[model samples]
Target: MPDLPSGAVTFLFTDIEGSTRLVKQLRDRYAEVLAEHQRLLRAAFAAHGGHEVDTQGDSFFVAFASARDALLAAVEGQVALLSHPWPEGVQIKVRMGLHTGQAVATGGRYTGLAVHRAARIGAAGHGGQILVSQAAQTLLEDEEEDLHVFLRDLGEQRLKDLDRPVRL
Candidate 1:
């Protein structure tokens, strides 16, 4: 795994979709499913040079040196979850969001509007969806990598606590 960023970095937030329902639906087996979910997601993050910031329940906050790397981790995580075989017929889906901006890294944690914006973007997305902020999208625009083909223009989106709509 790559070193975790200590300064300005891209933030990636992920939450298991329908977690409450899954918890009740899976009951005793939920713990096993959750462990697998964490393993799968952490593997993707490691592969993409992401540093885990915090995780509470099914939500994870990760940091990456590059916005592209953060986005790649999100895609990789989603793809992994989509194909994972759950116990019984249960299913798990995750919603991920990414944003690139300056953050204050203190005590191994990041704080600032960038973190909040990243969380809001994650909340706005549905299961299996990857949402990127305008800043991040612009960073990837000049690149000719195959990743560009997977990005969907969601247009401008009004995020919570933000004063204006941002081009997504």
Candidate 2:
């Protein structure tokens, strides 16, 4: 198993939008599409030191040592997915969400509120959209690295099952 990050970690959660519809539409080819999607995402994530925490169906939960790495991985993954040629001119759009906070990693899984927050943030976004929680954004803003990444204030909003509202 890969070494999952412990303590303060940036979590990135992603999933394909309308995957059921895509599966129905693509049938046998859907498996191939999913495989390619995973490949592209894994490559991008690994390139930026992202640890693959978990993946189920068309969703991925990855951890990064830094918020910047997580954001960079998301951007690279999105670009790769968009540019890839699918078998039937099909577009596979993935939604990504990032959050940075304290967490505990044990037995190849993470246990903490931050993990849930990250998953909820990702669930709130549309396919092809990358959402960042305020926690992650704050860390990113403090970094000196010029990622050339810009974020528009999505305004604070309450996410499902989350006690406090998050700024997207």
Candidate 3:
């Protein structure tokens, strides 16, 4: 992986909700559903110009050139999942977090406080919720209303492995 050029970039982290329980309950059936979910998420990310950087189980890490694109992708992903039917007793919801900041990309991987912050924010969000950092929020403030998405400020939250609280 090559190093990412120095500049501001937006990071988006998403994870499926209740995945552990679903997998435990559905067994082989859960695997099939998860595969379909990944396909849908991948398409949504690509459609919004998001770069799929990494995937760990049901969690996806993506990078975008702009905050707007990240937000749109998150919303679109949720909408797409909502429209799909799931196996009985299986509910698929996604939690997403977005942050904008400078990061170092190397070996086709991204690292830095930005990525950590984004992950923290994602953890703070409830299933089916999209949480954006203050920087991301500022970028989307003007357009959020027009986009018909409601963004509730979550103030500051202390995240694991981070020194300071991240605003979402």
Each candidate structure's count of clashing pairs: 0, 0, 3
- What candidate 2 gets wrong by more than 4 Å, as runs, is 143-145
Question: Across residues 81-166, which tens digit of lDDT does each residue of candidate 1 receive?
Answer: 99997877787989898888888887777788888988899888999898888888878887627675467789989988888886
TM-score of each model, paired residue for residue: 0.92, 0.96, 0.93
Candidate 3 backbone overlaps, count: 3
The best-first sequence of candidates by TM-score reads 2, 3, 1
Per-residue lDDT of candidate 2, residues 1-168 (tens digit): 878878889999999999999999999999999999999999999999999988999999999999999999999999999999887659899999999999999999999899999999999999999999988899888662588878878999899999889999
Candidate 3 scores a C-alpha RMSD against the true structure in Å of 1.9
Best by TM-score: 2
Candidate 1 residues lying further than 4 Å off, grouped into runs, are 1-3
- Candidate 1 has its poorest 10 consecutive residues by lDDT at 142-151
Each model's C-alpha lDDT?
0.86, 0.93, 0.86
Q: Model 1 clash pairs? A: none
- Pull out the clashing pairs in model 2: none
Please give, for residues 1-168, the per-residue lDDT of candidate 3 as tens digits: 323334688899999888888888888898899898899988898898888888999999999888888899899998888888887667898998999989988778888888888888887778889989999999888998888888888788888888888787
